[model samples]
Target: MRISELKKKGLESLKGKWGKAVSLMLLLFLINVILPYIVEVIGSGGFVQWFDQEGTPLWSDIFGTVLSIVLIPLTIATTWFYLDLVRKGNPEITEVFAIYKDGKTSLKLIGGSILQAIFIFLWSLLLIIPGIIKSIAYSQLFFLLRDHPQYTILEAITESRKRMNGLKWKYFLMNLSFIGWGFLCLFTVGIGLLWLIPYIGTTLAAFYDELIVLQEDEQPIEG
Candidate 1:
């Protein structure tokens, strides 16, 4: 699908659902952003004190890192929620925490996320461009895992890399297409992200759906 069509599909899916979508995004912001900020403030005593110290408390930084790692499943859950919204048009808010209900799935998501991060970091050590390319290549890992329960974490990572072949530039362009909206959001003091986040998420889900169709079409027919 063309990037325009994918974005159009995302907007269509979001019709009559903007409120719910924004609410979900707000919940994520609370967990991923606000909660961490709160932890940092408490750990450092206050912004004034933190400035006097000249750096964040070591324990605060460590806690933030550990919290992010522990919340990896939440990221996958967000992907799942958007996929469901695009595919079924009625994604439940609870879907944001669905992965946590399945211990094994949660573990797999966390492990895959860590592995992908390490690989991207290693590539980044070589150069920024290679890191960006590798990050795009692994972008579909969560979606693949959601759709293919049988795939081990490594298998899903491998499949994401394989399927992204020849499509990295297109995917990069698709993300670049959001730059205009991003700048506009800055004008809103980031408030517009409540809507923009869901728009981007649904569009990504649409992109994954297109990839699945393309993959199916490429399969050789049995005699």
Candidate 2:
């Protein structure tokens, strides 16, 4: 589907489910924002900012390294929660906490996430373009991890790279379609984010779903 169609259908699907949608965004907001705020009030700026204060070189800098470690799990949890909604058509706020309930899978996800950051960072040293390409390459890592937590870190990253083959531009355009909403969220001092977050999220989830379904249809049938 085109990016516009995905966003249109995604919001249409969200019409009556505003309650769950808001709740899901709120949960994510707390982890990414409130936790940082708490640290900022009690000490220096939180994770990302605190690292920025140091004079590390941008290329080898551990800023993204440290930041990725923090953000990746949140990313995983958010992806899994929304993918569940995508599958079940019901949004349970508790889905946000579902990641914590797992010990083994969580560890594996963290490992996979760090490797993702490392590979991207290494590629980035050669040229920023390669880094961006690698970013798109691994874009589906967490989503793949969601259904296949059994996948090892290497396997998860490998499969995400495979899943994204020939489809990066579509995903790129899909994300590009949200640029206006992103700026609007900034203008609102983030008030717009509550809606914008779920809007973009579900659309991406929809994109992933569309890809998975397309791949399934293309597979040679079993005997």
Best by lDDT: 1
Runs in model 2 deviating more than 4 A are 39-71, 216-223
Candidate 2 residues 1-223, lDDT tens each? 7778877767776777778888777776776667644554335445676556655445333444565565666667876666655565775676666666777776777887778889999999999999988999888778766766666677767777777888888888888888888997898998888888878888888878777446634322221
Task: State every prediction's TM-score relative to the real structure.
Answer: 0.89, 0.79
lDDT of candidate model 1 versus the reference: 0.85
Question: Of the candidates shown, which would achieve the greatest TM-score relative to the real structure?
Answer: 1
Question: What's model 1's lDDT at 205?
Answer: 91
140 in model 2: Cα distance from truth in Å?
1.0
List all candidate RMSDs to the true structure: 3.4, 5.7
